[model samples]
Target: MNLNLAVISGDGIGPEVVREARKVLDRIAEKYGHEIHYTDLLMGGASIDVHGVPLTDETIEIAKSSDAVLMGSIGGNAATSPWYKLPADRRPEAGLLKLRKSLGLFANLRPAILYKELQDACPLRKDISDKGFDLMIMRELTGGLYFGARETKEVDGVMTAIDTLTYNENEIRRIARRAFDIAGKRRKKVCSVDKANVLDSSRLWRKVVEEVAKEYPDVELTHMLVDNCAMQLVKDPAQFDVILTENMFGDILSDEASMVTGSIGMLASASLNDSKFGLYEPSGGSAPDIAGQNIANPIATILSAAMMLRYSFDLDKEADAIEQAVSQVLAEGYRTGDIMSEGCKKVGTTEMGDLIAERV
Candidate 1:
């Protein structure tokens, strides 16, 4: 099999981590008797420097031509980076928003897995951490509050802002179906989180999701209020298998879930369209502070490549090879600074990639 990937080595440590991910992918291709082609395109600050825009028409066209996109982090420190000085639409993160919108990527999947080897790194209480958790947050990316209408104006001689929160049945149902489908592959439990108690939008979301639940009888479905769900994440994360929610709620919860695992550098995310095409990326941001130091952890990006293999290319065996290699490396006590513990052998970004690739 041949895989064509659009590479967006965005900014800061983006290029570093992306380089490592490519190294792992190359090894996977070699071991599996498959061919992989990478089209290097710029986005974020890199694109802003060269093309005078965070994303260009040419880059979008190249991305559209590829089977999938593998991206590193985008943007830089908002407090200092020149990229952030630009207009809102021209900033580095705007490129990502544009790319997702252009690609019709609606479903965002963020897996928060507490690796047994990294149990010491977990921030949760010892008892809670010992139980461990493997949960996937299925976020409805393209719809709901984030994309809804909003404006600030004078109301009754007072300055007020109104942000519309809306969701159609189709949008809610589609994401709900995706959640149940993925739950069927996992532990067959879907915890749909929403604010149905107060928000009409969430009420519609609940109705649509409940209707969709009837189609997947084998998948156990439950509903939790967003606030309670937030509390439940830290209180009993092990209880969740698949967390299904709307755009805003998923965005907040996924970040919260990532933190509970203890290291943002270890989390991987995917954004998919209605089709199989998807964009895979690390959940962490571009760490401009460590851009050229080679101390950055590439595990998230490499794992993201694994996700690309599984979700986009449908090469389950190949994907497993990469994931197992990562686990084996971690088990062997290889650690990057972000995930380093007292007794483990610390390695640079490149060396960690080398270790995982060699294992693969």
Candidate 2:
């Protein structure tokens, strides 16, 4: 198999982590007898420095030509970076938004797994952390309050702002089906979260999801209000296998879920279209503060590459190889600065990548 990937080593620690991911992928290719090809494309602040824009049409065309995109973090210190001074549409994050919209990537999957070795790093109560949790957040992207119409106007002599929140049955059903399909592969349970009690949009979401549930009888389905779901995440996270929710709620919940596991640097995310094509990336930021120090954590990005192998290429064995290598390295007490514990051997970004790659 020849796997072609578009590499977006965006900015800050993006290049560092992306470099490590490529090393792991190279090792995977060597061990699995597959040929891997990479096309490097720039976006975000990196692109801005060279092309004077966050993203270019040329970069988009290159991305479209590839099998999947593997990206590191984008943007920099908002308080000081020149990228943040640009117009909203020209900023680093805007480029990411544009790419997601251009690629028609609507289903965002974020996995939050508390590794047994990192149980001490978990922020939850020891009892709750001891139980551990492995959950996937299936977020419906591209449609919702985030992409809806918005404006400010004077209403009854008062200045008010309004942002529309809308969802069609088609959109809701598609994401629900994706969630249930993924749940079938994992624990066969889907917890659909929404604010159906007050919002009409959420009511429509609940209705459509329930309608979709009938198709997946093998998958057990349940519904929870968004607020209650938030509470439940900390109270009983292990109870959830797959969390299905809309754009706004998912955006918030996924971050909360990441933090509960102790290090966002360990979380991996994917955004897929209706097909197998997807964009894989780390759930953490670029961390401009540690950009050139070689001290950044690359596990999330490497795990993201594993996700690309599983979800995009459908190479389960290859993905498992990478994932197992990561687990083994952690179990051997190898740690990056972010997830470092007292008794663990701390390593730089490159050394961690080398350890996992050697294990693979």
Candidate 3:
């Protein structure tokens, strides 16, 4: 199979980690007798430097023509970087938001798995960490509060701010279906999180999700208010399989889930439309502080490539091989600085990628 992937190596440590992912991918292509073609496209601050914009029409078109996208982190220090000095809509992250919306990548999948090898690195108590959780947060990305209308203006001589939270049944149904479908492949449990008790938008979200639930009877469905869901994540993460929620709540909860799994450097995320096409990326940001030191972890970005193989290309066996290689490497006590424990052998960014690729 020929895999045409659009590579957005973003800014900061994005390029470094993405380079390792490509190394691992090249090994996959070689061993599996597949041809992988990567079209290097620019976005974020990198694009800003070259094109004076975070994203461009040419870049977006090229990305759309590819089978899938594999991206690293974007943006830099809000305190120092000129990228941050730009207007809100012109910042690096705004480019990412624009790209996602333009591509109609509505469903985001952030899997937080507590690897047994990294149990010591987990911040949770030994008891909670011992139980080990491997949950996927299936977030509705394109709709809801993030894209809704809002403005700040004077009302009765007082400054009032209003941010709308809206969701149509179609949007809720589609993402809900994606969640249940993924849950069917994993543990067959869907914990739909929302603020239905208070927010009318969440009320509609619950209704649409329930309406969609009838289509997948094999998948057990349950609803939890967003507040309880937040508490439950820290209290009993093991209870969740696939967490389904709308935009704003998902944005918050996914980040919370990332922390429970030892390090954010180990988390991989995917954003997909209704079709099979998806954008796979690491959940961590552009760590400009550690960007060029080669100390950053590339496992998340590598795992994200595995997600691309599985979700976009439907190359399940290849995906399994990459995942198993990651697990094996972790089990062997090779660690990056972010995930380092006392006894494990520490490796730099390139060496960590080399180890995983060699294992693969």
| Worst 10-residue lDDT window, candidate 1 | 163-172
| Tens digit of per-residue lDDT, candidate 1, span 1-360 | 989999999999999999999999999899899899999999999999998899999899999989999999899999998888899999999999999999999999999999999998889999999999999999999988789899999989999998888889988888898899889988999999999999999999999999999999999999999999999999999999999999999999999999999988999999998888999999998999999899999999999999999999889898899999999999999999999999999999999999999999
| Candidate with more favorable, higher lDDT: 1 or 3 | 1
lDDT of 3: 0.93
Q: Give the TM-score of candidate 3.
A: 0.98
Cα lDDT for residue 272, model 2? 93
The better-scoring model by lDDT among 2 and 3 is: 2
Q: Candidate 2 — which pairs collide? A: none
Please provide, for model 2 over 1-360, each residue's C-alpha lDDT reduced to its tens digit, 9 standing for 90 to 100. Answer: 999999999999999999999999999998889999999999999999999899999999999889999999899999999888899999999999999999999999999999999998888999999999999999999999999999999999999999999899999988998999899989999999999999998999989999999999999999999999899989989999999999999999998999899878899999998888999999999999999899999999999999999999999999999999999999999999989999899999999999999999
What shift in Å separates residue 85 of candidate 3 from its native position after superposition?
A: 2.2
Tell me the RMSD of model 2 versus the true structure: 0.8
